[model samples]
Target: MNRPPELKRTLKNRHLQLIAIGGAIGTGLFMGSGRTISLAGPSVLFTYIIIGTFLFFVMRAMGELLLHNLQYKSFVDFTTDILNPTIGYYVGWSYWFCWVVIGMADIVAITGYTQFWWPEVPLWLPGIICIIILLTLNLLSVKLFGELEFWFALIKILAILALIGCGGYLLITSFVSTNGIQARISNLWSYGGWMPHGWSGFFAAFQIAIFAFVGIELVGTASAETDDPTTTLPAAINKIPVRVIVFYVLALTIIMTVTPWSMVAPDRSPFVNMFTLIGISAAATIINFVVLTSALSSANSGMYSTGRMLYGLSRNGVGPKVFARLSASGVPQNGLLYSCALLLIGVFLLYAEGDVMKVFTIVTTVSSICFIFVWAVILIAYLRYRRLFPEAHARSVYKMPFGIPMCYVCLIFFAFVLYLFSQDKDTLTGLVATPVWFILLTLFLPLYRQQLKKRISYTDSKHNH
Candidate 1:
């Protein structure tokens, strides 16, 4: 019998690595970090690292599970095999929704970044252009998509390194005050001392801090397209920690130390604000380019994930049949076009409303919560995998640390994140919308089931009838 329609293994380990980094680092850290730090004070560092650490295990459990079964395909497939097909359908569509929402946020940001170049340019123009460009890149081919994402992500990684280097220079030279805030190590402990806002503030930031790590699982999505899923998967995953430390913790530390939490502008992007504060010539243009690249990376990644998710769903006989079609280049052209068309809606919405952040936040936060749900599924899958294959769990080359206990801890932390969203006003707004979206999805589920069953039953009945 022929194999089910599946994604070809086209992505190399390098492509997978950069895609993961691109997904992990997005418009959030570039622009949103200033707001997060302002809310929680210096303790925001702890917030990022803590959430990052826990998520590392979630990915580890997922990585191990994916490697153990090369046929696992995507998280949806893994969930389907262990759980039920219903859960797979929910998770698959949930992820697609997640990326669509994230694409909107990034497009909104792209328009916002346009202000740096031509203040007179209507935001919608750039937003529309960005959508067009990303859509084209995605529809081209999977390899081209990988290449675009690779460079988009590289720009971000380089930008972070540049900032880190600059910050270190400032700290070492005891850079003099622009805002009467001298550059020094004292910034970490200064101004109301470390946890200035207390544990409540620290925990409160987790509501959205978790959002920063939302796409870290993009690596797993590439499992099917990855060359040597075994070696590449583990290699890509093993670097998650080192990436978090250098890119997240070290970079955040340098930023806070060099600029001081008090000096960072909450209204402006920390990346742009820091460069301007440090007296970089042409700072606005430099940061604008980097932010533009960041936005492009987000949109590009949004397309990649949506395409793969659709492919996975189709293999399970859940999504549109066209999504199962692949081009000679080994890319899923139909899914790419379909997802890109949906993402273009974001550009239109940005045109309609001057303020798209509310829309972006509500949608993206739902996506983040969906990510939490997906992670829980991964852990549950891991726990089940261990039970069935104890030898693999015990002697596996890449096993999750702390096994079941760690899984429980990650689950509790996710629950705590949900609680934090409920308490915070900004996040609570997003939390309120989650149920409504699910209900909208749930209301359509029966019809979806009917249509799905009708098609399958027809296929089977034809042979007998």
Candidate 2:
């Protein structure tokens, strides 16, 4: 008998490593950093560090669980096995929603980045082009998708390293900007203390900071298709903290030190603006290209993830069965097409809202809320695993440090971030809107269970015959 179609383990260690890095560093760092710096001043560095530390533990919990059972494809599967299937349905679909929203955010961000060079181009044009290109690339094969992210991530790493090196030179030389402000390390605190805007601003930064880390758990999703996941997954996950600090904290520190936090443009990319302030027009252009590709990298990742997520859900009977079918190349062609179709809503959003930042802020807020729910479920699943299989937990080489207590700690941290959402106008809209997704899930779950039962009964009948 022929084996049924399945995702091939084509992703190598290098692909997994670069993908983990790519997932952690997003357009949020390149574009949204300006807004975060404006809100918390230099204290934004601490915001990145705190968020990164908590998420590292979350990844640890997920890594240990995924490694414990090589048969598990993703967190959704373990959640169903460790907990109830109902909650698994909720998480599976919610994660798909999270990536869809992020994909839309990337489309909007791409248009914004293009406007840097072509201010007169229609916003919808670039967004459409981005969706088509990403869709075509994704439909080819998983390995090609991995290759694309590998190169895209490499570009981002190079750009940030160059920025840091240039910024350090400016600080040592006490270089003067064309605007007449001198670059100095004191820029961090001289304008205002670390918490320039006080506690309220520091607290407000979490909503956006959390959005910046939205895709960090993607390694969990990619684990199923990874070659020798036991080694690749742990190696990829172990490097998250270092990637977060260097890509986010260190990079932002250099930007704020070179250009005072107060002067940073909330509406523009600080990466490009930092170069512009120093009168390096050519460098600014190059940086713009990097950030542009950064947004494309994120959107491409979204396409890859959402396709796989839908395929997972469908294979389990929680989503449409069509999504379970893979192409000859071992790609989820139907799921990819479905996700790319929805991404067009982004062009509509751009046309309707007419302001890139405004649309980005609203969508990112909703995406962050959804992601928080998904992460909380992962931690809860880990808790369930520990209680159910103490032997497995003890025998596992990749144990989660402070397992039970840390799960509770991560859950509490997620709740605190959710509470922070209500304090702001834009984010409050998202917090209120997020419940609608759960309500819909609750409504459709019964039908899904019924379908699941019918599938099982039919399979039993065929076997008996």
Candidate 3:
């Protein structure tokens, strides 16, 4: 019997490490932190810590599940097994849609980022060019995808490190900016005493803070392509705390310390502003290039994830079989092409209306809501796995600590965030738009099942003849 084409496990440990790092840091940290700080004040620090902690546990559960079976392609596989095929279909498609929406927003962002350097360039042109370039790279090979993400993630890491280093130097020397504010640790508390906007502001910050962690789960998706899941995955998951602290908590602390929360502009990137305040005259242009890479990195990850997810869906008979076809290089070319084609819709929107940021907000909120659903599904799947297969859970080498209890905590946290979304008109619009996606998936399931049955019957008949 001929086996189906499979993805190559050519990704090394370094690739996996950088991919995990890249996933944790997105444009949200670079571009969106200013808004979060403005809304929640210095308390935004706690917002990130709390969210990152919960998501760490979520990733642990996913790690345990993925390592339990090497044959499992990703979370969507076990989800289908532990739950039902119908749910598997919804989760797979929804996950794909989540990245698709994110990719669209990132492309729009890329256009805006490019405008900083080339003011006359049409918004849609850069978006179209980026999509094409990323598409070509992804279609080549899995190794190539891993290599690109490795470098993209490295740039982001270096940028954050430079910020922390520069901020530290300013603080130790008590450097005073042209604006007359002295760089010191007390800036975090001197102005408004941490909770500048109070608890209400802290709670509101979750809306934006959660978006910063959107791609943190990409490590789980890469499990299939990783060289050794058992060793590499645990190593990757164990470092979540340190990564969250250094990249998110410590980095933000440094920013707020050097410059008071009050001085940060909500409409602009704090990263660019921080450098400019410290006398980097060309900070705008330099940060623009960094942010451009950040956006491209995110869009690149989105394309990779969407392609793999579609392939997983097809393998399970939930999507068209054509999506399951692999190129000579073991790349999911059809899936990649389909996802990129859908992403062109963003370019179309840019042509229709020259408002990239408006589209970005709507799509970002929608992506965040979808991610919450996907996380909840993982927890639910974990609960089902523990209940149905106690022996397997007992024998598993990598166990999720306080697994059952933590699942509930994460769920409640997600529900609270969803409620927070209702408090704002823009986020509320996204929250409302979420159900339409699930409803569409629900309506299509029966038809999908019928198609699967027909495909099976035809395959059996051809084999027998």
Candidate 4:
């Protein structure tokens, strides 16, 4: 495959590190977690851990493969080279759809976060403006994209760390409040007990718990642009399990401990609610900023991944050739604009009255389904790649753990999660949206494939003539 001429290596290890981390820690962890807790109670922590464990292996497979081939630009390219053109087609475009839906969810969340300050400001305006601002920043340079992700990620990391530290200190100190309450780890099981809500609830939360780990594949999508992807890519992907455990598991454990499983509100952020419980009015402001950064980080990641996917699809003759155009800085301007435009449409959803969140829930469900689809395809690609190119794969170093068996296991598990979504009302959208998205993509792909094939054929015919 020909390299995009204008593409350059500008992103460094730190930028990639922060960008990967940024993508993982966002509105899902900051806000959507409460819903999970409401469903599972104290058992939600275990659900996150299990899903995280599976995702860790997925990232490991991607990291090993990426490290093996320095020239392999993105996971889409990997899919094409390893599997077949059709798999690449589905994975590339589905991944693009994944982020667009996610971007909409994040933008709606931005409107929700802003409601902290101006209750009357109407959600859609802020969501729309936020997309416009991010689009401008993305057009500038890849480094700028990296920088934005870095700082936004930094804020999220700091907030989680601070919240964890505070929760820990309060637990350790056995801090007694002026009121009747005392913060302690004992609160986790004290109210409802470990399985307070019983097996059903514990299992029910699996839908949301898995969704928290949705963007774990993000680093794989941006593999091409990073400097020295071999070392940096592995370093970034290696952090998946740790972040999943710390940011999701440990953080939630703390919230459950301090606030009690029964006390954690379903509608509000556990982070923000904890602070308010501690009588820190100032915490609302701090958490507002953190959530804003979280939203920014989410949008930033959406922009980055969406652009590269476009570039990748174009590379595979699955999208517009113009999308393959890169800036001198190696950033795909057209791709960024395209993704950001969809993100801006999220604002209208935000502004819409009467069950806007229901729409947001629908979007999130669809996004989650899209994410699962891409992930499952990657696993299939890995399975096929290893089988057909055992020699090619063996000659190279990078490989997923448990080899082909892991692929089957992950498939069953992912399929089960999809099933769980159907069983649970909270995650019904994810299940329902899969067919809806599939119908749209199935219809859309034929036209694109035809157009792209024509373009390729025309170029080939011209040369032959």
10 residues in a row with least lDDT, candidate 4: 456-465
Clashes of 2: 0
Cα TM-score of candidate 2: 0.93
lDDT for each of the candidates?
A: 0.79, 0.87, 0.88, 0.77
lDDT, model 1, position 144: 77
lDDT of 2: 0.87
The deviation in Å at residue 214 for candidate 2 is: 1.0
Best model number under TM-score:
3
Q: How close is every model to the real structure, measured as TM-score?
A: 0.91, 0.93, 0.95, 0.90
Question: Model 4 compared with the native: what TM-score?
Answer: 0.90
Estimate the TM-score for candidate 3: 0.95
Per-residue lDDT of candidate 1, residues 1-465 (tens digit): 955444567777889889888767766787778877877878888888888888889989988888777788788887776555666777898888898888877777787778777889975688778777776776666677878888889999999998888888889988876667778988888877888778887886677578788889988987678768888888878788788888877887888887778677777777776676678877778878998998888888888888878877776777777788876666677887788777667677766654575676677777888888888888887887777678767667888888899999999988888888888776778788888777876776674585556545653454244
Write one digit per residue (lDDT tens) for candidate 4, span 277-386: 66688887898889888877877788888988898788678787889888766688888888887777787775577687676777677778778777787777677667
Instruction: List the RMSD of every prediction in angstroms.
Output: 4.0, 3.6, 3.9, 4.0
lDDT of 3 by residue, 315-378 (tens): 8889988999999888999999999999998787677654665756776677789889889999
* lDDT sort, best first: 3, 2, 1, 4
TM-score, cand. 1: 0.91
Stretches > 4 Å off in candidate 3: 1-3, 354-360, 450-465
